[model samples]
Target: MRKSIIAAAFASLAILPAAASGAEEPPHVDYSFAGVFGTFDPVQLQRGFQVYKEVCAACHSLKFVAFRNLGDAGGPHFTEAEVKALAAGYDVAAIDNETGEATTRKGLPSDHIPAPFPNEIAAKAANNGSAPPDLSLMAKAREGNASYIHAILTGYDHPVPEGVQVPEGGNYNPYFPGGVIAMPKPLSDGQVEYADASVPRTVDQYAKDVSAFLMWTAEPKMEVRKRVGFGAILFLGALSVLLYLSYRRVWRNVDH
Candidate 1:
Protein backbone atom coordinates (compact mmCIF):
# COMPACT_ATOMS: atom_id res chain seq x y z
CA MET A 1 0.00 0.00 0.00
CA ARG A 2 2.87 2.40 0.83
CA LYS A 3 4.57 1.73 -2.53
CA SER A 4 1.26 2.13 -4.42
CA ILE A 5 0.60 5.52 -2.74
CA ILE A 6 4.12 6.69 -3.61
CA ALA A 7 3.65 5.68 -7.22
CA ALA A 8 0.37 7.59 -7.43
CA ALA A 9 2.02 10.73 -6.02
CA PHE A 10 4.78 10.54 -8.62
CA ALA A 11 2.24 10.21 -11.41
CA SER A 12 0.40 13.32 -10.21
CA LEU A 13 3.66 15.30 -10.13
CA ALA A 14 4.47 14.24 -13.66
CA ILE A 15 1.20 15.64 -14.96
CA LEU A 16 1.37 18.96 -13.04
CA PRO A 17 3.41 21.00 -15.47
CA ALA A 18 1.36 20.02 -18.49
CA ALA A 19 -1.83 20.85 -16.66
CA ALA A 20 -0.50 24.25 -15.63
CA SER A 21 0.72 25.01 -19.11
CA GLY A 22 -2.64 24.15 -20.62
CA ALA A 23 -4.41 26.48 -18.22
CA GLU A 24 -2.12 29.42 -18.84
CA GLU A 25 -3.37 32.26 -21.01
CA PRO A 26 -1.95 33.22 -24.38
CA PRO A 27 1.14 35.42 -24.69
CA HIS A 28 0.91 39.22 -25.07
CA VAL A 29 0.98 41.03 -28.45
CA ASP A 30 3.82 43.21 -29.74
CA TYR A 31 3.64 46.30 -31.98
CA SER A 32 7.15 47.67 -32.20
CA PHE A 33 7.68 47.22 -35.96
CA ALA A 34 6.17 48.87 -39.04
CA GLY A 35 4.50 47.28 -42.07
CA VAL A 36 5.58 47.23 -45.76
CA PHE A 37 6.13 51.00 -46.18
CA GLY A 38 9.01 51.18 -43.67
CA THR A 39 6.77 53.84 -42.14
CA PHE A 40 3.37 54.19 -40.49
CA ASP A 41 0.22 53.98 -42.52
CA PRO A 42 -1.30 57.43 -42.89
CA VAL A 43 -4.78 55.94 -43.03
CA GLN A 44 -4.23 54.02 -39.80
CA LEU A 45 -2.80 57.08 -38.14
CA GLN A 46 -5.82 59.11 -39.16
CA ARG A 47 -8.14 56.42 -37.86
CA GLY A 48 -6.20 56.26 -34.62
CA PHE A 49 -6.45 60.03 -34.33
CA GLN A 50 -10.17 59.78 -34.76
CA VAL A 51 -10.42 57.14 -32.04
CA TYR A 52 -8.26 59.22 -29.72
CA LYS A 53 -10.23 62.40 -30.32
CA GLU A 54 -13.58 60.70 -30.02
CA VAL A 55 -12.96 58.07 -27.35
CA CYS A 56 -9.65 58.29 -25.50
CA ALA A 57 -9.01 62.06 -25.28
CA ALA A 58 -11.66 62.64 -22.65
CA CYS A 59 -9.92 60.41 -20.10
CA HIS A 60 -6.31 59.81 -21.13
CA SER A 61 -3.82 62.42 -22.31
CA LEU A 62 -1.14 62.47 -24.99
CA LYS A 63 1.29 64.67 -23.11
CA PHE A 64 4.33 63.81 -25.19
CA VAL A 65 3.06 64.55 -28.70
CA ALA A 66 2.65 68.02 -30.17
CA PHE A 67 -0.08 68.96 -32.62
CA ARG A 68 2.61 70.15 -35.02
CA ASN A 69 4.07 66.64 -35.21
CA LEU A 70 0.89 65.34 -36.77
CA GLY A 71 1.77 67.01 -40.06
CA ASP A 72 4.77 64.77 -40.56
CA ALA A 73 4.80 61.73 -42.92
CA GLY A 74 1.57 62.80 -44.62
CA GLY A 75 -0.85 62.34 -41.74
CA PRO A 76 -4.35 62.39 -43.12
CA HIS A 77 -6.90 65.22 -42.58
CA PHE A 78 -4.55 67.42 -40.50
CA THR A 79 -2.83 70.23 -42.36
CA GLU A 80 -0.08 72.51 -41.10
CA ALA A 81 -2.55 75.31 -40.43
CA GLU A 82 -4.91 72.96 -38.61
CA VAL A 83 -2.12 71.44 -36.52
CA LYS A 84 -0.89 74.86 -35.47
CA ALA A 85 -4.44 75.93 -34.69
CA LEU A 86 -5.07 72.84 -32.65
CA ALA A 87 -1.84 73.17 -30.68
CA ALA A 88 -2.80 76.72 -29.83
CA GLY A 89 -6.12 75.75 -28.21
CA TYR A 90 -4.86 75.13 -24.68
CA ASP A 91 -2.98 77.09 -22.00
CA VAL A 92 0.62 76.02 -21.45
CA ALA A 93 2.87 76.51 -18.41
CA ALA A 94 4.21 79.82 -17.16
CA ILE A 95 5.40 81.49 -13.97
CA ASP A 96 2.77 83.06 -11.76
CA ASN A 97 4.01 86.45 -10.55
CA GLU A 98 1.67 86.96 -7.59
CA THR A 99 2.49 83.66 -5.87
CA GLY A 100 5.84 83.16 -7.62
CA GLU A 101 4.65 79.75 -8.67
CA ALA A 102 5.17 78.14 -12.07
CA THR A 103 1.74 77.50 -13.54
CA THR A 104 0.09 76.85 -16.84
CA ARG A 105 -0.49 79.99 -18.85
CA LYS A 106 -1.35 78.97 -22.38
CA GLY A 107 -0.30 76.60 -25.14
CA LEU A 108 3.28 77.21 -26.22
CA PRO A 109 6.13 75.31 -27.86
CA SER A 110 8.01 75.04 -24.60
CA ASP A 111 5.39 73.78 -22.19
CA HIS A 112 5.10 70.14 -21.14
CA ILE A 113 1.66 68.76 -21.87
CA PRO A 114 -0.82 69.03 -19.07
CA ALA A 115 -2.22 66.08 -17.11
CA PRO A 116 -5.91 65.25 -17.01
CA PHE A 117 -5.75 65.34 -13.24
CA PRO A 118 -3.52 67.40 -10.99
CA ASN A 119 -2.28 64.22 -9.34
CA GLU A 120 -2.88 60.47 -9.07
CA ILE A 121 -5.01 60.96 -5.97
CA ALA A 122 -7.21 63.42 -7.79
CA ALA A 123 -7.52 61.14 -10.78
CA LYS A 124 -8.57 58.18 -8.63
CA ALA A 125 -11.04 60.26 -6.69
CA ALA A 126 -12.67 61.35 -9.90
CA ASN A 127 -12.82 57.86 -11.41
CA ASN A 128 -14.42 55.87 -8.57
CA GLY A 129 -11.17 55.44 -6.71
CA SER A 130 -9.26 54.17 -9.72
CA ALA A 131 -6.43 56.26 -11.09
CA PRO A 132 -6.21 56.69 -14.83
CA PRO A 133 -2.59 56.10 -15.77
CA ASP A 134 -0.66 58.57 -17.90
CA LEU A 135 -0.57 57.35 -21.52
CA SER A 136 2.30 59.51 -22.75
CA LEU A 137 4.72 56.61 -22.54
CA MET A 138 2.30 53.71 -22.52
CA ALA A 139 3.57 52.25 -25.78
CA LYS A 140 7.12 52.30 -24.55
CA ALA A 141 6.21 51.48 -20.98
CA ARG A 142 4.44 48.21 -21.70
CA GLU A 143 5.66 45.08 -23.44
CA GLY A 144 3.94 43.78 -26.61
CA ASN A 145 2.25 47.00 -27.66
CA ALA A 146 -0.35 45.47 -29.99
CA SER A 147 -1.20 42.73 -27.53
CA TYR A 148 -1.43 45.28 -24.78
CA ILE A 149 -3.95 47.34 -26.72
CA HIS A 150 -5.96 44.36 -27.87
CA ALA A 151 -6.05 42.82 -24.42
CA ILE A 152 -7.00 46.17 -22.91
CA LEU A 153 -9.84 46.84 -25.34
CA THR A 154 -11.03 43.27 -24.98
CA GLY A 155 -10.22 43.03 -21.30
CA TYR A 156 -13.88 42.83 -20.39
CA ASP A 157 -13.85 39.09 -20.84
CA HIS A 158 -14.60 36.57 -18.06
CA PRO A 159 -12.91 36.94 -14.73
CA VAL A 160 -9.71 35.18 -13.74
CA PRO A 161 -9.90 32.02 -11.58
CA GLU A 162 -8.11 33.73 -8.75
CA GLY A 163 -11.33 35.19 -7.34
CA VAL A 164 -10.59 38.60 -8.85
CA GLN A 165 -13.60 40.83 -8.73
CA VAL A 166 -14.45 44.12 -10.47
CA PRO A 167 -16.26 46.32 -8.02
CA GLU A 168 -19.27 48.43 -8.89
CA GLY A 169 -18.73 51.12 -11.52
CA GLY A 170 -15.24 49.68 -12.08
CA ASN A 171 -13.82 47.65 -14.98
CA TYR A 172 -11.79 44.46 -15.34
CA ASN A 173 -9.08 43.70 -17.85
CA PRO A 174 -6.56 40.92 -17.73
CA TYR A 175 -3.81 42.91 -19.49
CA PHE A 176 -4.01 46.07 -17.36
CA PRO A 177 -1.17 47.01 -15.03
CA GLY A 178 -3.18 45.52 -12.23
CA GLY A 179 -5.43 42.65 -13.24
CA VAL A 180 -8.35 44.61 -11.86
CA ILE A 181 -9.00 48.03 -13.45
CA ALA A 182 -11.80 50.56 -13.34
CA MET A 183 -11.80 51.64 -16.97
CA PRO A 184 -14.11 49.45 -19.03
CA LYS A 185 -13.52 48.29 -22.56
CA PRO A 186 -14.23 51.41 -24.63
CA LEU A 187 -14.50 49.79 -28.05
CA SER A 188 -16.83 47.21 -29.55
CA ASP A 189 -17.69 45.92 -33.00
CA GLY A 190 -19.12 48.74 -35.10
CA GLN A 191 -18.93 51.08 -32.13
CA VAL A 192 -17.51 53.71 -34.46
CA GLU A 193 -17.57 53.89 -38.24
CA TYR A 194 -14.77 55.01 -40.53
CA ALA A 195 -15.09 57.06 -43.72
CA ASP A 196 -12.21 55.15 -45.28
CA ALA A 197 -13.61 51.99 -46.81
CA SER A 198 -10.26 50.31 -46.77
CA VAL A 199 -10.20 50.49 -43.01
CA PRO A 200 -12.68 48.26 -41.26
CA ARG A 201 -14.95 49.78 -38.63
CA THR A 202 -14.60 46.90 -36.16
CA VAL A 203 -13.32 47.35 -32.63
CA ASP A 204 -10.30 45.15 -33.36
CA GLN A 205 -9.42 47.32 -36.35
CA TYR A 206 -9.79 50.45 -34.26
CA ALA A 207 -7.64 48.98 -31.52
CA LYS A 208 -4.91 48.09 -34.02
CA ASP A 209 -4.96 51.51 -35.64
CA VAL A 210 -4.97 53.40 -32.38
CA SER A 211 -2.24 51.18 -31.02
CA ALA A 212 -0.12 51.86 -34.10
CA PHE A 213 -0.69 55.56 -33.70
CA LEU A 214 0.33 55.46 -30.06
CA MET A 215 3.43 53.54 -31.07
CA TRP A 216 4.25 56.35 -33.48
CA THR A 217 3.57 58.90 -30.80
CA ALA A 218 6.12 57.11 -28.65
CA GLU A 219 8.75 57.06 -31.44
CA PRO A 220 8.04 59.61 -34.15
CA LYS A 221 11.63 59.49 -35.44
CA MET A 222 11.64 55.72 -36.09
CA GLU A 223 11.12 56.29 -39.79
CA VAL A 224 14.34 58.24 -40.05
CA ARG A 225 16.27 55.48 -38.30
CA LYS A 226 14.81 52.82 -40.55
CA ARG A 227 15.61 54.83 -43.67
CA VAL A 228 19.20 55.44 -42.55
CA GLY A 229 19.77 51.75 -41.80
CA PHE A 230 18.39 50.67 -45.17
CA GLY A 231 20.56 53.19 -46.99
CA ALA A 232 23.70 52.05 -45.13
CA ILE A 233 23.00 48.42 -45.93
CA LEU A 234 22.64 49.16 -49.64
CA PHE A 235 25.79 51.24 -49.68
CA LEU A 236 27.77 48.51 -47.92
CA GLY A 237 26.47 45.88 -50.34
CA ALA A 238 27.62 47.94 -53.34
CA LEU A 239 31.01 48.50 -51.73
CA SER A 240 31.38 44.78 -51.06
CA VAL A 241 30.65 43.95 -54.73
CA LEU A 242 33.14 46.56 -55.97
CA LEU A 243 35.82 45.25 -53.58
CA TYR A 244 35.26 41.68 -54.78
CA LEU A 245 35.72 42.73 -58.42
CA SER A 246 38.84 44.73 -57.56
CA TYR A 247 40.30 41.73 -55.67
CA ARG A 248 39.69 39.48 -58.68
CA ARG A 249 41.49 41.93 -60.99
CA VAL A 250 44.41 42.40 -58.60
CA TRP A 251 44.89 38.62 -58.01
CA ARG A 252 44.67 37.74 -61.73
CA ASN A 253 48.44 38.28 -62.24
CA VAL A 254 49.40 36.34 -59.02
CA ASP A 255 48.89 32.88 -60.69
CA HIS A 256 46.97 29.98 -59.13
Candidate 2:
Protein backbone atom coordinates (compact mmCIF):
# COMPACT_ATOMS: atom_id res chain seq x y z
CA MET A 1 0.00 0.00 0.00
CA ARG A 2 2.84 2.41 0.82
CA LYS A 3 4.63 1.62 -2.47
CA SER A 4 1.41 2.07 -4.44
CA ILE A 5 0.73 5.48 -2.83
CA ILE A 6 4.26 6.67 -3.59
CA ALA A 7 3.97 5.54 -7.20
CA ALA A 8 0.66 7.42 -7.55
CA ALA A 9 2.23 10.58 -6.09
CA PHE A 10 5.09 10.42 -8.57
CA ALA A 11 2.65 9.90 -11.44
CA SER A 12 0.67 12.96 -10.40
CA LEU A 13 3.83 15.03 -10.17
CA ALA A 14 4.87 13.92 -13.65
CA ILE A 15 1.49 14.96 -15.11
CA LEU A 16 1.82 18.53 -13.79
CA PRO A 17 4.56 19.61 -16.18
CA ALA A 18 2.80 18.08 -19.20
CA ALA A 19 -0.42 19.93 -18.39
CA ALA A 20 1.46 23.21 -17.89
CA SER A 21 3.38 22.74 -21.14
CA GLY A 22 0.14 22.46 -23.13
CA ALA A 23 -0.47 26.21 -22.98
CA GLU A 24 1.30 28.19 -25.71
CA GLU A 25 3.68 31.07 -25.02
CA PRO A 26 2.32 34.50 -25.88
CA PRO A 27 3.81 35.80 -29.13
CA HIS A 28 6.20 38.74 -28.77
CA VAL A 29 4.95 42.24 -29.62
CA ASP A 30 7.22 45.25 -30.25
CA TYR A 31 5.35 47.85 -28.22
CA SER A 32 6.44 51.51 -28.31
CA PHE A 33 6.88 51.60 -24.50
CA ALA A 34 9.66 49.04 -24.38
CA GLY A 35 13.35 49.29 -23.27
CA VAL A 36 15.09 51.95 -21.13
CA PHE A 37 14.54 54.98 -23.34
CA GLY A 38 10.99 54.01 -24.40
CA THR A 39 8.16 56.51 -24.34
CA PHE A 40 4.42 56.14 -24.95
CA ASP A 41 2.83 57.39 -28.15
CA PRO A 42 0.01 59.73 -27.13
CA VAL A 43 -2.15 58.86 -30.12
CA GLN A 44 -1.79 55.12 -29.53
CA LEU A 45 -2.69 55.56 -25.89
CA GLN A 46 -5.79 57.54 -26.86
CA ARG A 47 -6.91 54.91 -29.34
CA GLY A 48 -6.29 52.22 -26.72
CA PHE A 49 -8.52 54.05 -24.22
CA GLN A 50 -11.23 54.24 -26.85
CA VAL A 51 -11.08 50.48 -27.37
CA TYR A 52 -11.29 49.86 -23.61
CA LYS A 53 -14.26 52.16 -23.19
CA GLU A 54 -16.28 50.88 -26.13
CA VAL A 55 -15.49 47.17 -25.90
CA CYS A 56 -14.04 46.08 -22.56
CA ALA A 57 -16.02 48.43 -20.29
CA ALA A 58 -19.13 46.26 -20.48
CA CYS A 59 -17.31 43.42 -18.72
CA HIS A 60 -14.12 44.71 -17.05
CA SER A 61 -13.43 47.72 -14.85
CA LEU A 62 -10.60 50.19 -14.31
CA LYS A 63 -11.25 50.75 -10.61
CA PHE A 64 -7.84 52.24 -9.83
CA VAL A 65 -7.83 54.83 -12.64
CA ALA A 66 -9.43 58.27 -12.62
CA PHE A 67 -10.75 60.52 -15.38
CA ARG A 68 -8.19 63.24 -14.62
CA ASN A 69 -5.41 60.82 -15.50
CA LEU A 70 -6.40 61.19 -19.14
CA GLY A 71 -4.99 64.71 -19.10
CA ASP A 72 -1.81 63.85 -17.25
CA ALA A 73 1.57 63.96 -19.01
CA GLY A 74 2.86 60.80 -20.80
CA GLY A 75 -0.58 59.23 -21.18
CA PRO A 76 -3.52 59.79 -23.51
CA HIS A 77 -3.05 63.54 -22.72
CA PHE A 78 -6.66 64.56 -23.29
CA THR A 79 -7.29 68.23 -22.61
CA GLU A 80 -8.77 69.47 -19.32
CA ALA A 81 -12.10 70.22 -20.97
CA GLU A 82 -12.22 66.80 -22.57
CA VAL A 83 -11.44 65.10 -19.28
CA LYS A 84 -14.16 67.03 -17.47
CA ALA A 85 -16.66 66.30 -20.22
CA LEU A 86 -15.85 62.61 -20.13
CA ALA A 87 -16.15 62.54 -16.34
CA ALA A 88 -19.56 64.18 -16.46
CA GLY A 89 -20.89 61.39 -18.66
CA TYR A 90 -20.40 58.68 -16.04
CA ASP A 91 -22.61 58.23 -12.95
CA VAL A 92 -20.66 57.61 -9.77
CA ALA A 93 -21.68 56.74 -6.25
CA ALA A 94 -21.69 59.69 -3.88
CA ILE A 95 -23.06 60.91 -0.58
CA ASP A 96 -26.00 63.28 -0.56
CA ASN A 97 -24.62 66.00 1.73
CA GLU A 98 -27.99 67.43 2.73
CA THR A 99 -29.76 64.13 3.31
CA GLY A 100 -26.62 62.23 4.48
CA GLU A 101 -27.60 59.35 2.22
CA ALA A 102 -25.82 57.37 -0.47
CA THR A 103 -26.72 58.56 -3.94
CA THR A 104 -25.42 58.52 -7.47
CA ARG A 105 -24.09 61.66 -9.15
CA LYS A 106 -22.26 62.72 -12.28
CA GLY A 107 -18.63 61.60 -12.07
CA LEU A 108 -15.79 64.02 -11.43
CA PRO A 109 -12.16 63.80 -12.44
CA SER A 110 -11.37 62.54 -8.95
CA ASP A 111 -13.83 59.67 -9.07
CA HIS A 112 -12.46 56.23 -9.76
CA ILE A 113 -13.68 54.20 -12.71
CA PRO A 114 -16.79 52.20 -11.82
CA ALA A 115 -17.43 48.49 -12.03
CA PRO A 116 -20.09 47.01 -14.30
CA PHE A 117 -21.53 45.01 -11.38
CA PRO A 118 -22.11 46.14 -7.82
CA ASN A 119 -20.21 43.31 -6.16
CA GLU A 120 -18.13 40.23 -6.85
CA ILE A 121 -21.15 37.94 -6.51
CA ALA A 122 -23.10 39.98 -9.02
CA ALA A 123 -20.14 40.12 -11.39
CA LYS A 124 -19.66 36.36 -11.20
CA ALA A 125 -23.38 35.67 -11.65
CA ALA A 126 -23.41 37.80 -14.78
CA ASN A 127 -20.31 36.21 -16.30
CA ASN A 128 -20.97 32.48 -16.05
CA GLY A 129 -19.44 32.15 -12.57
CA SER A 130 -16.22 33.82 -13.74
CA ALA A 131 -15.80 37.40 -12.58
CA PRO A 132 -14.14 39.60 -15.13
CA PRO A 133 -10.94 41.02 -13.65
CA ASP A 134 -10.28 44.73 -13.30
CA LEU A 135 -7.90 45.93 -16.02
CA SER A 136 -6.26 48.65 -13.92
CA LEU A 137 -3.12 46.74 -12.92
CA MET A 138 -3.55 43.84 -15.32
CA ALA A 139 -0.45 44.77 -17.30
CA LYS A 140 1.76 44.62 -14.22
CA ALA A 141 -0.05 41.71 -12.56
CA ARG A 142 0.25 39.25 -15.43
CA GLU A 143 3.50 37.40 -16.17
CA GLY A 144 3.85 38.39 -19.84
CA ASN A 145 2.15 41.75 -19.20
CA ALA A 146 0.95 43.43 -22.42
CA SER A 147 2.05 40.63 -24.68
CA TYR A 148 -0.08 38.15 -22.75
CA ILE A 149 -3.12 40.40 -23.00
CA HIS A 150 -2.63 40.98 -26.72
CA ALA A 151 -2.19 37.28 -27.32
CA ILE A 152 -5.38 36.40 -25.48
CA LEU A 153 -7.35 39.03 -27.37
CA THR A 154 -6.14 37.75 -30.76
CA GLY A 155 -5.79 34.06 -29.87
CA TYR A 156 -9.43 33.33 -30.64
CA ASP A 157 -8.71 33.34 -34.35
CA HIS A 158 -6.79 30.07 -34.16
CA PRO A 159 -8.68 26.81 -34.59
CA VAL A 160 -8.97 24.50 -31.61
CA PRO A 161 -6.39 21.77 -31.70
CA GLU A 162 -7.42 18.10 -31.87
CA GLY A 163 -8.11 16.27 -28.56
CA VAL A 164 -8.94 19.45 -26.71
CA GLN A 165 -12.23 19.50 -24.88
CA VAL A 166 -13.31 23.03 -24.17
CA PRO A 167 -15.59 23.48 -21.21
CA GLU A 168 -19.20 24.58 -21.62
CA GLY A 169 -19.49 28.30 -22.35
CA GLY A 170 -15.67 28.53 -22.44
CA ASN A 171 -13.76 29.49 -25.60
CA TYR A 172 -10.57 27.75 -26.66
CA ASN A 173 -7.50 30.00 -26.52
CA PRO A 174 -4.18 28.23 -26.49
CA TYR A 175 -2.45 31.24 -24.96
CA PHE A 176 -4.80 31.13 -21.99
CA PRO A 177 -3.91 28.74 -19.22
CA GLY A 178 -5.67 25.35 -19.46
CA GLY A 179 -6.45 26.26 -23.09
CA VAL A 180 -9.93 27.53 -22.10
CA ILE A 181 -11.17 31.01 -21.23
CA ALA A 182 -14.62 32.10 -20.11
CA MET A 183 -14.65 35.36 -22.02
CA PRO A 184 -15.81 35.08 -25.62
CA LYS A 185 -14.15 36.77 -28.60
CA PRO A 186 -14.59 40.43 -27.70
CA LEU A 187 -13.31 42.07 -30.89
CA SER A 188 -14.16 41.73 -34.56
CA ASP A 189 -12.93 43.31 -37.78
CA GLY A 190 -14.36 46.82 -38.22
CA GLN A 191 -16.16 46.62 -34.89
CA VAL A 192 -15.03 50.09 -33.81
CA GLU A 193 -14.84 53.09 -36.10
CA TYR A 194 -11.61 54.92 -35.35
CA ALA A 195 -11.61 58.72 -35.51
CA ASP A 196 -8.26 58.62 -37.26
CA ALA A 197 -8.81 57.71 -40.88
CA SER A 198 -5.30 56.25 -41.23
CA VAL A 199 -5.59 53.66 -38.48
CA PRO A 200 -6.95 50.27 -39.49
CA ARG A 201 -10.20 49.23 -37.86
CA THR A 202 -9.35 45.60 -37.13
CA VAL A 203 -9.09 43.15 -34.26
CA ASP A 204 -5.29 43.09 -34.30
CA GLN A 205 -5.01 46.86 -34.08
CA TYR A 206 -7.56 47.01 -31.30
CA ALA A 207 -5.68 44.37 -29.32
CA LYS A 208 -2.37 46.19 -29.69
CA ASP A 209 -3.87 49.54 -28.79
CA VAL A 210 -5.67 48.28 -25.71
CA SER A 211 -2.62 46.39 -24.55
CA ALA A 212 -0.58 49.58 -24.71
CA PHE A 213 -3.29 51.49 -22.81
CA LEU A 214 -3.35 48.88 -20.06
CA MET A 215 0.40 49.14 -19.75
CA TRP A 216 0.05 52.88 -19.28
CA THR A 217 -2.68 52.37 -16.70
CA ALA A 218 -0.51 49.91 -14.81
CA GLU A 219 2.50 52.21 -14.71
CA PRO A 220 1.34 55.76 -15.32
CA LYS A 221 4.62 57.18 -14.02
CA MET A 222 6.80 54.88 -16.10
CA GLU A 223 8.14 57.70 -18.24
CA VAL A 224 9.02 59.86 -15.28
CA ARG A 225 10.58 56.92 -13.53
CA LYS A 226 12.70 56.06 -16.56
CA ARG A 227 13.83 59.64 -16.90
CA VAL A 228 14.85 59.83 -13.26
CA GLY A 229 16.69 56.51 -13.48
CA PHE A 230 18.64 57.65 -16.54
CA GLY A 231 19.55 60.94 -14.87
CA ALA A 232 20.81 59.11 -11.79
CA ILE A 233 22.90 56.81 -13.96
CA LEU A 234 24.46 59.77 -15.75
CA PHE A 235 25.23 61.59 -12.51
CA LEU A 236 26.87 58.49 -11.07
CA GLY A 237 28.92 57.93 -14.21
CA ALA A 238 30.19 61.52 -14.16
CA LEU A 239 30.97 61.32 -10.45
CA SER A 240 32.93 58.09 -10.97
CA VAL A 241 35.06 59.75 -13.65
CA LEU A 242 35.73 62.78 -11.46
CA LEU A 243 36.72 60.59 -8.52
CA TYR A 244 39.03 58.49 -10.72
CA LEU A 245 40.74 61.65 -12.03
CA SER A 246 41.16 63.06 -8.54
CA TYR A 247 42.68 59.79 -7.32
CA ARG A 248 45.10 59.75 -10.26
CA ARG A 249 46.15 63.36 -9.62
CA VAL A 250 46.61 62.83 -5.88
CA TRP A 251 48.52 59.52 -6.26
CA ARG A 252 50.58 60.58 -9.33
CA ASN A 253 53.60 61.58 -7.23
CA VAL A 254 53.30 58.59 -4.82
CA ASP A 255 55.16 55.32 -5.51
CA HIS A 256 53.11 52.09 -5.71
lDDT of 2 by residue, 1-256 (tens): 9999999999989887647656777889999999999999989999999999999999999999999998898999999998999899899988999999999999898888778889889989999999999999999987789998999999997888899898888999988888899999999999988999899998999999999999999999999999999999999999999999999999999998
lDDT value for model 1 = 0.70
Among these predicted structures, which one has the highest TM-score? 2
Q: If scored against the real structure, what TM-score would every candidate get?
A: 0.70, 0.90
Query: How does each model score on lDDT?
Result: 0.70, 0.92
lDDT tens readout by residue for model 1, 1-94: 9999999999989987546433223245444354534567777787887787678876787877766667777333367676666557767767
The per-residue C-alpha lDDT of model 2 at residue 114 equals 78
Q: Candidate 1 has which clashing residue pairs, if any?
A: 29-147, 91-106, 92-106, 92-107
Weakest 10 consecutive residues, lDDT, candidate 1? 20-29
